[model samples]
Target: MEVKKKLLDLVRDKIRFKHYSYSTERTYIHWIKHYILFHHKKHPIEMGKIEIELYLTKLATNDRVAPTTQNQAFSALLFLYKEVLGLDISEWNIQALRAQERKHIPVVLTKEEVREVLQNIPSEYSLLVHLMYGCGLRMSEALNLRVKDIDFGFDKIYVWDSKSLKDRTIPLPQKLKAKLLEQVESVKLLHKQDLKDGYGNVFIPYALEKKYPRSKLEAKWQYLFPMKSISTDPRTKEKRRHHVMAQTLGRNIKVASQKANLNKRVTSHIFRHSYATHLLQAGIDLRSIQELLGHKSVETTMIYTHVVSEMNKAKVISPLDF
Candidate 1:
């Protein structure tokens, strides 16, 4: 038991050392633990490529996990062997039966549908939701926004170090400018109260925190959409105001979809898809949209073209209609 715990502790240390997010740390730990238990608590060092292949194959053939899920498990194990165990499994040439990936066309809402859904969303999340749709932000990017990232003077929003590992700028929505300013004022008030309570610190990356020790205490570094109350940081055990949880936003979106009585499913990413598709419909160039969405490849952004084509298929008359 001690050995297993120590191994996981080392993995945690490495992940933190690499500056991975807490969510990623939790997920990698989960897969690693599951891998060890599946082999009856055998130390990972004792197993080699064969054992790894067997486990992954079982996930596909028996457990029926999705391709991405299986790939994630594989990545965790690979990290364990190569990084933690100091073993080079690259030449092992383990061939496991891979799970099949399904092709999916993303669900998108029409402009009217988007309006109906946004109207049904709770007032508290209205601005955030609008920002997501307006600026084509992922839920994480929207929630992680800090006060300094918004450029009111320039009328742009700066997204830094996003999933694509690229920084991009988005044009601020004209309609939401007043609401956003009001939000910043509210955040300022909340920050003042937090400072008065001697708990104004927000989470900063370890390296940055060390470089600028007082940045965490600054109002501009605070989350744009902070939680209602301060909570203890899972890692540092410090009382800090973190942004709202993704789960809370997701739950509220689900409820709003129900209220709107939309026939199609609605998720946070749907807004992003709608954003891209709507842009394409407005004759925005694909390359420009790709930059706004922060896609690593233009190919990923091209999916919206197909979506627009499918939607426009109504204009074609079928033989039956003739």
Candidate 2:
């Protein structure tokens, strides 16, 4: 696993060129692994640019990966060539063999459908789903939520080091405020229990730990959804808690969706899509939604507008007709 280890380190180093979240770090690493495997485990240092191009071309034509996936592959390769191996990779204008995505709308759940889905979910998982819908949060954001981030008076949740490694705050739903307050009490109990047993210090990013040193014990630094117990931080060798895994939540939602008699392929992101669409449907402004979702560009928010327009399907008429 030497290559795997180096590959992981390479990914971390490469991400520093352009700031990306730990989530993106994980995703980039996965694609790099797949790319290496596709070439029958040939090392990137051994392969020339032409081989890299051909491999990517093969992925587009033969493997037929989706456009987003293909783009991610391109980015990973670009990073490998430009940063890791010191090679020039320029002008990727390649296209996937399949047609571009056009006029496609994201699958959205109705209010009743969302309610039923929540009802069908086992009680343990319901609160998480509520947070996802009630606040326009990506599942990872919800998973990484810490107890201190909840602001009961302001009805807001702080999201730090999100997908872009940038921090933003999204409002807490007024309806869910009561439940969140209760959850806060629950996290306090867990923290106290950890103290009594001598499970000292909290897990934070390796660099942050060295910088703040004492933040680990701070009440605000505790994970809103803390891990079951402290584990040795692989990077620092100190015991700390980390966020819950997204895959765990994904599996739980998948099984619950099936049991709820829903047929859609319900990944954790489907809830995020539903979040945007439902908010737009409820007469929330696009700019407001964009801010809440932490979108850097308004263009990203425009997609939800398309979803609503597609749903309405009203006919156009001349002024005379009016």
Candidate 3:
């Protein structure tokens, strides 16, 4: 209970500042728990650099954890000692965990294969995939889209508090406008149900809830892809509306991919990768693609250029060159 209470309070304060997500809070709590257990239940306050180093060493050697995971654990511990506990543990060092080089090429479906996959999905899942492919949205961003975010008048969709917690808008598809209208109607029904249950308030970041307390109940502010059921807020522990889980969408996709007889390991990301590659192949400028994808750097967009179909069409290839 001591370890749990200490961490829960620290994480709650961290969340109160609006500095991280519920997922980050959960991950930090987990690492702290593991760190404590590594010391035979000794409090980290009484612990020192040597104990932390031994734990990190175990994660690298005995656990053989992946490099990314090792880095995460390192970061969580760093935050705990310096930020949470106010301890100067900066002098402490551990052997860096070796990381496998991440492969650069994202899996991309061929142009025709994309159509085949699209043809096979059910209506709801198909729409989700379409937005991901058409707008270059992350699956979560597509699922989390609010009704007000769509701007048919301006032909743009606003993405708020995304990966970097930055707001950006990109053009809306004229093709999908009718589908958005139908989707909004469904969201209205879900909004009514939440109102009936006295749980109309949907989660919003920091001051937005105070600015518009009833906004969650309003049709305009409802999620474009509302979850099938209401959810309890992690911070307040009150039932509120949330968007459909990406896992639900993923399962639906998995079933459809099997039905479609797709041999390539299919995922929601495949659609996003196809979006970039297809746009590049169609001769859209890289800077334009960068904006659509919400990438901070042009470097991320450059990966799609590596796909075979992006090669110069005018180049003459000789069979003898190989």
**What would the TM-scores of all predictions be?**
0.98, 0.82, 0.87
Highest lDDT, which number? 1
lDDT of 3 by residue, 1-322 (tens): 7766876587568656755777788888788889888888887789887787788778878888877787788788887877777876777655454545466678788878888888888886777788877888888889889889988789899998788556789788778889987887778877887788787777776577788786656788877887777787777797877887878888887777788788988898888888888888898999988888888889878888877444554366787886
Q: Candidate 3: where are CA atoms >4 Å away?
A: 1-4, 88-95, 309-322
Candidates 2 and 3, the one with greater lDDT:
3
Whole-structure CA lDDT of model 2: 0.76
- Please rank every candidate by lDDT, starting with the best: 1, 3, 2
Give per-model CA RMSD.
1.0, 4.5, 3.1
Top model number, TM-score? 1
Least accurate stretch of 10 residues (summed lDDT) in model 1?
Answer: 82-91
Clash pairs, model 2 backbone: 146-224, 147-224, 203-240, 203-241
lDDT of 2 by residue, 157-210 (tens): 899877655688887788888887877787778887777787646766667777
Give the alpha carbon lDDT tens digit for every residue of 1-322 in model 1.
Answer: 9999999999999888889899988989999999899999999988888899999999999999999999999888878888888887877987999998997888999999999999999999999999999999999999999999999999999998999999999999999999999999899899999999989999987899999999999999999999998999998899989999999999999999999999999999999999999999999999999999999999999999999989989789999999
Better of 2 and 3 by TM-score: 3
